[model samples]
Target: MRYGIVGTGMMGGEHIRNIRLLDDVSITAIADPVESSLDWAAQSLGDQQPARFRSAEELAEKGEVDAVIVASPNFTHRAVLEPLFDRGLAILCEKPLATTIADADWIVERAARNPAPFWTGMEYRYMPPVARFIADVHGGRIGALKMLSMREHRFPFLVKVGDWNRFSRNSGGTMVEKCCHFFDLMRLIVGAEAERVYCSGGIDVNHLDERYDGETPDILDNSYTVVDFANGVRAMLDLCMFADGAEHQEEIAAVGDAARLDVLVPPGDLVFSPRVGFGAPKQVVREHVAVDDMAMEAGSHHGATFYQHAAFARAVRGEGPVEVTAEDGRRAVLIGAAAEISAREKRAVEMRELDTTG
Candidate 1:
């Protein structure tokens, strides 16, 4: 597979590194407005430098690549994807799909109508731990599903990726820009559509003028959301990038009637607690059963990126379902957008109100 990448920023660079590791796929072209970014990518990939284009249009018209990976800013996703769709090229787009519901809907509609495969960069779905957790839940290791709680905490944005992400108009706030990953995870764990969402957030940190230029930072720096799923499952997400000294922390805990499963981190430690009952005033019996010892392996964020790219490549070859479909991406955006609306309005917002049909 010959792959072309748009936007050579952090995510784009990660994609380049991962694609280089794959056996059959080659990054044939790269598109970025910044000359420095293109030069850096070309230099990093040894002698087999990818063709560089100044814009998505130029790349789509001249690159003649088999697949295009859109890792540009949030607002540029639709613009990059439209040309790729017209050219009948498979695509692997970064999360959040687009900054707005209408734009996201357009991409979803295109994917439904087009023959070329479209995959979203919700790479967490490929993590071995997460995958195993999903399987266990589906296998009924945990009784009836109850709730999901996840927290993604980290330091403030440090990497300089243009000025688009600092403002909500460009990135659709931090919730939509960053929390889409958590929202997507919640959806996967709940296995149900989000019925309602209530949120609260504020830009209490990272209030630097350089970050937002003269424009006010409308994007929240800290956010909390409660999502109600249609299957009587509730999910709570806490996303805060302003936490001091915290590199990153991610955990997903699922509560069930008989057993509880918790994925501690990227390595995804699964702890199962079977329900135990004791007689009140009579007698107590203890059962000695050895706990399952599944060795957890640390995961490379870059490896997850490579895994996602490989899945996209395989899907293009008509192998299997996309790791993360276009509809999945749209749902993530819808959840995040609804959370933002809820935060702004100080009330719970129905997810259906933000759905495509609405």
Candidate 2:
């Protein structure tokens, strides 16, 4: 299969590298407005030459590709996807499907009518340990799950092509920008839709002294968001973008009546703690999940990009189902939109308030 990458930035280059690892697949084309990004993609492509275009429109018109991966900036997703959708090409759009709910709703509507497969790229779901954790939770390892909490203590956002991510207007706020991955995971693990969202976040640490055109960055660096799912499942996210010194960049825990399950990303350990009476012998088991060396080397996402691409390839070949659909992307964006509103308004926002389906 031949693939075309819409944005040739860091994530786009990651996709190119991992796609090269897939059998019988090649990155046939790439498009980006910035020349430096195009050069970066070229470097990643090595000797394999793919047709290069300056814009998605140009690529859609001139490039020959079986499927397209939209890794463009958050604000430009809807615009970049237009021509590709019109061409009836299979698409794997990166998450927070769109910066706003209206655009996400439009994408959902269009995707439902398209004949080709539409995939939302939620890479975290494919992480080996996280995938196992999700399966174990659903397999009744954690019986009657009561609470879910996630923490991402990582460095600040890296430099994009044009500093497009420093502002909420372009990146969809920190909640929708970075937290969408966690929100998506929360929904997937809990197997329920979010009913309400409450968040307290602000631009506390990162990018304080940075200025673009005399305007300081407005994106939040830390946050605490609570999501109330329809099935009475409550999830909380504790995000600290300034805590790069921490040992684990991401950690997730799910507690139930029976026990609690936890997964740490770096070492990729799954810990199971069963309910034991006080003073009883504690039996806490820790198992390490391993990822393919090549897949791990290909990207920073702990081989998730490779696994997600593998699944996407199967979907394109009619060998498997599209695991993450346009609706899934929309729902994730809805929860994120609510979180952003809640943080700004200092109140809990009901899911119905942002229900674009109606």
Candidate 3:
């Protein structure tokens, strides 16, 4: 399948590398406003260099591509996607499909009615350990899930895309920008739909002089959220973007009837243990099973990206299941939107009542 890439940023570059690894896929075209980014990709790919364009609309209009990967800025998603949707081309869009619920709903509704496939770039679902853990949980190894906890703490925004990510209007704040992964993962593990959400956060640190359309930054850098699912499951999400020393930390813990499971992303460890209770005059039983070294090699941080692309390619070729679907993407965005509303209103936001069916 021929693939076209829009937005030559960090995630876009990762997609390029991943596309290179697939035998059936070729990146036919790339579009970015930045000349240097387009030039850099052309130089790196050599004979496989893609046709570079100045805008996503140009690529969608003129490029001979079967699929388009939208890795552009958060706010530009709808603009880029609307044109492609008209072409009836398959799309792999980055997470938080859009900055607002209305835009997300539009994309979801359009894709559902369109003939071509629409996939979201929620790559965390394709992670090796996460995939395995989900399988085990579904297979009843962990029994009925009860609670979930996820944390993501990374260093300050020193990277190039860091500036754009600091604003809520641009990046959808910390909850949508960063914690969407956790929210989606929580949904995947619990096998439930979030019924309500409550969040508390603010721009406590990382006070960079970043502005969106000349407005002061409104995105939160630190956040904590509680999500209640319809299946009687609960999830807590903790996110911080200004950790001084920590390089990166991501983990998800789920408590079940038979065992407790913890998935640590950095180390790629899925530790399982039987539930044990200690009493004043009783011995403690130790039952822990650790599945370590489950992630791809250290340099291959784009494993899930590669896997997701391959899955989409196969699906286009009339193959097996696609990793993440448009409906899944819509739910992720809905959860994030609910969290944002909860944070703003200082109250729990109900999920199902929201007009997301569009």
Candidate 4:
């Protein structure tokens, strides 16, 4: 399969690297306004050099590609996708669909009409351990899950091409920008839509001393968000951007009537605790999920990006279904936008208040 990548930044580089690991595939074209970024993609390409363009429009119009990966900045998602959608090429746009509901909805509308596959790049679901945990929960091992929680304690956001992520306007706030993965997982595991959202977050630590053109960064460094699902399942997220010292960068737990299940990254272990008597012998089981060495090295997402690319390739080849759709992307943004509103207003926000139908 021939591929074209838009926005050759850090993530664009990651995608190029993983695509190289797949069979019968090559990045035949790449587009990015930044000459340095284009050079980076060229260096990553090594022996094979694909056609290069300065914009998505030129790539769609002139480049020879059967698929495109939109790894552009958050705020530019909608605009970058317009020409690509017009071309009807298979696309794997990265997470958080858009910075706002309106733009996300727009992408959803266009994606539904496009003939080619439209996949949302949500790699969290494909992480081996997390994938196994999700299957166990869905297979009734958790016994009708009642509550779910996710925690991401990691370093602050890294430097982007132009510091575009330092502001809420560009990166969609921390809730929509970084936390959308957890929210998307919540929806997937709960099997229900969110009814309300409450979040308490702020830029307490990271980027406080940083400035761009005399303007301070306004993105959140930590937050505690609670979501109520329509199926009566409650989910919570604890995010701390200043906790890089923590052992695990991401952790997720699911509790039901029978027992509680937990998954931890880094070591990639799945822990299961079945309910015993009040004082009976305690029993706990831990299983390690291993990822391929090359896959693990392809990206920083614990081998998720590699697996996700494989699945996307299947859908592109008509061998499997599109696991993550544009609607899935929009739903994640809906809940995230609600969280942003709740954190700013210091109150809970109802999902219906967002009017996602637009």
- Candidate lDDT (C-alpha), each: 0.80, 0.94, 0.78, 0.95
- What are the per-residue Cα lDDT tens digits for candidate 3 across 1-358? 8989998877787888777777867889999988888887787678987788999889988898999999998888999998899889888899878877788778878988768888888888877667777787888877888888888787664454446765778877667776777788888888888998999987777755756577666777788999999899999998887865564477677788877877766666777777656543433233322332322321145257666666888877778666677777778878888888888889899886675463
Model 1 lDDT tens row, 102-197: 999999999887778888889777665666677788788779889788887767765556767777888977878889988998888788889999
- Candidate 4, 19: how far from true, in Å? 0.4
Worst 10 residues of 1 by lDDT: 289-298
**What's model 1's overall lDDT?**
0.80
What is the TM-score (0 to 1) of candidate 3?
Answer: 0.90
Instruction: Give one digit per residue, the lDDT tens place, for model 2 in 1-358.
Output: 9999999998998999999999999888999999999998998788998999999999999999989999999999999999999999999999889999999999999999888999999999999999999999999998999999999999999999889999999999999989899999999999999999999998887999999999999998999999999999999999999998999999999999999999999989999999998999999999999999999999999999999999999999999999999999989898888989998899999999989565
- lDDT string, candidate 4, 27-112, tens digits: 99999999999999999899999999999999999999999999999999998999999999999999889999999989999999
Instruction: Name the top lDDT candidate.
Output: 4
RMSD of 1: 4.5
Q: Candidate 3 clashing pairs? A: none
TM per candidate comes to 0.90, 0.99, 0.90, 0.99
Relative to the unseen true structure, what is the C-alpha lDDT of residue 194 in candidate 4, on a scale of 0 to 100? 95
